[model samples]
Target: HEAPSPEEHLQARTSPLRIEPPFCQQTDDFAHNSTLHGISHIFPYERGWIKRCLWVVFFLGSLTFLLFVCVDRIHFYLEYQHVTQLDEISTPAMVFPAVTFCNLNSFRFSRVTRNDLYHAGELLALLNQRYEIRDIHLVEDNVLEALKIKADFHNFKPRPFNMREFYDRTGHDIKDMLLACHFRGTECRPEDFQVVFTRYGKCYTFNAGNEGHTPLITTKGGMGNGLELMLDIQQDEYLPVWGETDETSFEAGIKVQIHSQEEPSFIDQLGFGVAPGFQTFVSCQEQRLIYLPPPWGDCKVTPMDSEFFESYGISACRIDCETRYLVENCNCRMVHMPGDAPYCTPELYKECADPALDFLVERDNDFCVCEMPCNMTRYSKELSFVKIPSKASAKYLAKKYNKSEQYIAENILVLDIFFEALNYETIEQKKAYEVAGLLGDIGGHMGLFIGASILTILELFDYIYEVIFPFSHVVYIGRNHYSKERGQYFTSLRKNCLLICSHIYQMLAL
Candidate 1:
């Protein structure tokens, strides 16, 4: 080798770094003052101060980040668990429909008698003071049959006794008001009733049954002619409950029978769907009830009133052996019935407003599926209301108004279950227990469980520190002489968290 040139020697002496031997790794662990890459070149002795600072920041940041995630996940889990738990334990509630089961049905007469139930137009007038009842349905059945499915009472076995008749034979009218749990179903279903009279309205019903006897059969056919309900109304303002009027006769042509054939078998009509048995009320023809009022005695009967009612061919009055008020055969509007009474009460409306006593609807065993969706009419004139479809969606609404689905579909106003909900307070409870077999809360602590699970997941994250760090740094991870171009560093995440907390406090103060 030739001797080094003078210029090369000069360059070496003037150079700030050595190009030969080991290269210094300044990216990590060493500064440019002393101990550079394990060589005492220009690595800084206090370089560890910066390193320690960075390490501390990174560790704290990562821990803070991880903690925040843990809190968020736990909160989410708790909320979810709460909802799930409620779902798991939910139960449905139901209602009843009748008083007795056996004698009311059986396809056989079973020694039962027929009694015509009449509408007292006066009663409607009385009710109008509180409600804006403009329309009425004209029919021969009880308000129950016209509005909803009938109820059922099992082993109830009520014995009929007329107080007047008893007094004639043994002396004394039934002192106690006949009462019974006349509404019940064998299965878990929705069975309820309602009375449409306005609050504090004066409406009276005729009693057709009594209790305290063994054989429900009328041995001597405890006789009676028909019933007449009386009403004192503002004819020009309020309307009848429901009935028909013949355009020609002006008197609705409702037929009447005196406990004889050619008339609807009152006993036969009793059952779970139509006229419930053991209950004081039963189904009857509107026209039949139109007559049969005693012009003398307690009722102050007026024959002229009968003539005017009869002239319309919609309502009238007649007489019978015992006592009778006047039955207003006229109804404001009439609609068909839907399905038989079910055993469930809807979860809408005030408790007292429940159809169990608030509506005039009657559930029956008739071919409701076919007869449903029937047109609503009054006094033989077509009405705005139409029939409902046999589908459940339709029927469900019908049950709410205590009318047939066929009727509900037509009165779309009531279809908004939420809207109707406001009409009544204390909705009937639905029994989630029977159907879903829910025992307690629907889903047990689902949110808590989910939160716990999220906690577990967070606990398993090994890179949590990095996530919590406020910032990351890159550095070579090899020895002083080794060179790795890039490495990562973590920075404090808690700083940002503290900032957020401080901001929240500021906002609250403001």
Candidate 2:
């Protein structure tokens, strides 16, 4: 063989060699046919353009309908609703066991004026006596710090009452007043405020000129002692206890009014995630002295069973039980507990408190030791002010009392509270399957009209899964082993041959 000439080499360099791509080239007829075959495996029923369009429409419509059904009926069945009418029936019984002064500003009467201090001091004394509060240590800064540290009845959240306005209207420094009453000073000594009671021989008197007396603070729907008050609420009536004041004198005269309501059908007393059915609406809408159905009675829950309560009166009792248990076991009382319980310092708590306290720290449920108190009705209250005249004014004395003026000009602030049956509804909250039932009903409708069942959903998912992941070729156990790269090609060839032979056999038979 002779070497190629320079002219041949120049020709080779100038004229580029043209090489065809693999058999699956984009424009090739065989490539197109193979693609159609693969597509046919995915969609066996799809044929022409019109058939493909119809299939697309069918798929979109079916998807839209399925989503609509799930969104509508599934959410509807998650929570239950029961109607309540406020006439000719007894309302649920509620109790008001205790009250909390929520705002730090409400305790600053000493800084405001001497009269404010005197009145607030006397009121603080009365409150300590009534509630048996051990200390009036108002958390001035980061009030929630203690609440964050300890789990107790005081932190039982989502309280039905709105105290924002109560504190806003009074704006009395309650902690200062307690200090004035207990320490007879401007503020309490950090060490002196051990128990919040009137000091021996220290009785503060409020002499608000004869025209006015220190705003007589009282409550209804709460158990009363001496000048204290509570309401005898019954069926069909929600008690709103508010303070009536002389708008002219700015005196607070708290009153309790009984209003009628239609009978309430308890939708769910399982109070875990469920709200106080009617109470939430009544308060949120500020619908005092008016009878109305719960506005949200027909509304569907976005996230079902969402309402919750962190603590209850029974929870307090359980803490007392736990305290008793501690006293029995370790001979020390926890400082966080209410009543005349002795304070358990940090060292004491560490030395004496059970390891169970650590266990129960952030848990949602109450004590496992003590069961809920039966026959005890629980109440929560909202304080609202209405303009009215002091009943102590002269309209009734000329007529003997000022009933008309009292009705019109007196500042009447009401504490509206409704009662509910108390029990452990946390863990035991039963789900109301409204949506599931609706789905079942839909299934029945399909069966009656279109011969379909919920199993159709399973079938649809299975079809989609098969399309995404088609079955692989069946290999004979003793066949030759092949590398992964060549195995796929060999399987495709075998499958194509089988299809062709089957087609030919059918053609021959025909």
Candidate 3:
């Protein structure tokens, strides 16, 4: 054939059909630093098929492991984030003690004009005119107004209840009235100590102290009321009625139950209601009040001045202490009328209420600073009625209505008055879940179930970094340059082989 031109020769060498091994090629410096060369150091790409398959398996497994970690992390965040959020968000526990005062039986009265004996049901309707006792309709319509009567009959109607009508409707069943008399006279006077009144006086001048009604704990119900009588008595105030007795005993002939309606818990039991719960007391044929076991024996309570805080509220002892602090410091009292300081006029009270209230707020911020007085007496009452002849001999009646019978029939009414305290629920902070323990549990479960560890995560990140960052070391030579190198190698090999065979043939011919 004619000698091929340089261009034609170059084309023939560079053709795809050329036969040559890759090692025979002369490569540039850039080619030596190519991607395949760098990848070979990290992973042997030229290995047998079995090794290649294994490498692919390892790569895919690592990717799956990373995916598992991602999923686990997402789950952990979703699950444990609530603990952090719960730690930040809190609400005051509904642990305030609730006192429910419901009358068990209505009073019976004799009619003066008609000589008729009255029924309890009739008395309930008439009492509704003076004070809402049984009309569930009125109570439901104006619960706040109805509850106020339980606290104090301050808004009683101007017209007195028709005594004749009252007597005609309830024949000598005066227990409900007696309850009203107790609450009405909760703001007691010195004369109240002399005798339990058949009626409460309408006087604003008496400052007998909270010697009437001071419950350490109170609830939404205020004091309960019903068609039955409500016996309202303070253990301290009714000491005379109980006679010279350090301790007294009587049957609480009515059902006693706590209305807290809270989830049962140690924290709830501490401040929510009475411990061991409440039960019913019965009196069969007795009609008198007596004392019971020494109340909250040996329990410590912060002593409060009953007279000093009579007007503000029944449980105004904390404010009383704060007011006392202000008086000692500023030499004045605030807006609390009937407080300890007689000199605190309206003008002085106006000036001091804000500052005093602020200081009280700050003082109460201290942990357990205004805790329930451990020693203060709490009051509760059991009311019941029985029909015994007015002229029945005391001994014969006592024998007939004996103590055990009195309990079932609830003739000997016993009132249990105690100071409900906050010894248990003073601490406000409670955890919905412990955060640290949850994290540990998740981590432990992951290790046990999936053989995963924190080290596995670090290794996954390392593999990703190696794969992406090593690209910086790789060099790219164009496809044309590689093809040209291969072509030159094959062409030279053919030429050299031809020269060698020609020399060997000449020697054989000689």
Q: Output the number of the lDDT-best candidate.
A: 3
Candidate 1: tens digits of C-alpha lDDT, residues 1-510: 897544454443333323322223332222333221222222444557666666556545555654565565555444322111111111122110112211111111111112101111112221222222224344324433422221122333444433222112221111211111121111111111111111111111122122332211111111121121111111111222342311011111111111211111122122122111111223321111111112111222333332222221111111110001111111111111111222111111112122322222244223111111111111111112222234656657557546554433332221000010111112111222231222112222222222223333344352344333312211211232123222211112244445557767888999
At residue 418, candidate 3 shows an lDDT of 26
Q: Can you tell me which runs of candidate 3 are displaced by over 4 Å?
A: 1-49, 55-101, 106-410, 414-510
TM-score for all models, in order of appearance: 0.18, 0.25, 0.27
Model 3, residue 88: displacement in angstroms?
27
Deviation (Å) of 150 in candidate 2: 44
Per-model lDDT: 0.23, 0.31, 0.34
How many collisions per candidate?
Answer: 149, 56, 41
Model 1, residue 129: displacement in angstroms? 14
lDDT of 3 by residue, 1-510 (tens): 698744455555545444232322312222233332122332444568777676567555655665676577556644433211111212222132222331222122122112111211122232233343444443334433433343243543333233324423432223322332232124322333211111110111111223553322222122321111233222211101112111112221222322221111112112121111122232111111111111312222334435643222223545455556677756865322235464443233335644565556565565224433332222233433334323344355446544233332234333333222212212122233345655666566545444446665565465555544433322232244556676767666577566557767877999
